[model samples]
Target: MIKNIIFDFGDIFINLDKIKFANELQKLGISQNDNTFTPILNEYEMGLISTEDFINYFKEKLQVSSHEIKKAWNCILLDFPIERLKFIKKLAKQNKHRLFLLSNTNDLHISWIQNNWGMDLYNEFKTCFEKFYLSHEIHLRKPNNNIYQFVLTENNLQANETLFIDDTEENTSAAAMLGIHTWNLIPKKEDVVDLFTKNHI
Candidate 1:
């Protein structure tokens, strides 16, 4: 009796090139070995730091311009298939389940998405959900137990009756630990449009 659905934004709806950011940064002389920036990135994702501060930090540390940093940061985002948007919209219209969107995203990535997808399209996608929670906006990221608990408690949702779909194993596993059902959907090989047939929902 799954009455609630939680979806991850990246890979679940919009496509992402996971390695594109790292590759783009590499082209700008930043490598994986530059681990010091990781904490700042995490802070940025959690909304603990302002976007200007984030850009400035990278600009000072990497000696890069704001434009370069923004470009590299947004390289991971790709396409949003209209078919998937249609599917979610249809699901929302059914009114059979409480729909939620929970994504580990930041301002820059979201900004890029709005610009790429158009604000109207983005708003249409958002209106499909009862609640749209972004990590930066909520100050809570996925794979964190508190974030899952926060969503559950806030919505008064029963974990056993909630289905969470995410592209990351870590996120799915964390949700499962709280008795929620999850599908660690494989991107490219699987599409959210096949949710009913593939997951047998």
Candidate 2:
């Protein structure tokens, strides 16, 4: 039986505009082509590279200043609604199973988030999780066999007893391979707040 829920933060909680980001990057001379940039992003997400290195790579490729690159790169992190925060808190109050947040995020993004939301709000937000695992902090990222193993072994969680929800199929499939139940949510059609109702919690 599933006893723990691992939630991914991006599309699952906050909305992202792929088209907006692409258009913004185009203004900054970055390619919208998946062939060129997606693999670089994938490598960074897999914990294969450092934040500074990733930023530097973009800055050089796009021939833009760090500030310009930073703005364009961080365009995905838009808003955090009180309703979403309330929903997570409500889920936590159930006290039925351990709740965790696992995201493949890096230092620069984290620093930007801290600055954007400020420390107090971030702490309040983080309090909703039994454990908050950010890739840069843990030095382990998603879609990797070792990172998934780290979460289970370190937390003493049974793989079959955990359910991971992520927007990325790659990450979910990797966890599913380890016997963890997964929901690769399609945000365009699905409402995360309705998971409990639809999944019949």
RMSD of 2: 2.4
* TM of each candidate vs. truth: 0.96, 0.86
Highest TM-score: which candidate? 1
User: Per-residue lDDT for 1-201 in model 1, tens only?
Assistant: 899999999999999997887799888777777886678878899999999999998788778999998988898999888899999999999999999999999999999999998999999999999999999999988798999999999999999999999999999999999999999899999888998987647
In candidate 2, what are the lDDT values of residues 46-102, reduced to their tens digit? 667887898889877877888887887788787777777888888888888899999
- Residue 100 of model 2 has an lDDT of 91
Candidate 1 overall lDDT versus native: 0.92
Worst lDDT 10-window in candidate 1 = 29-38
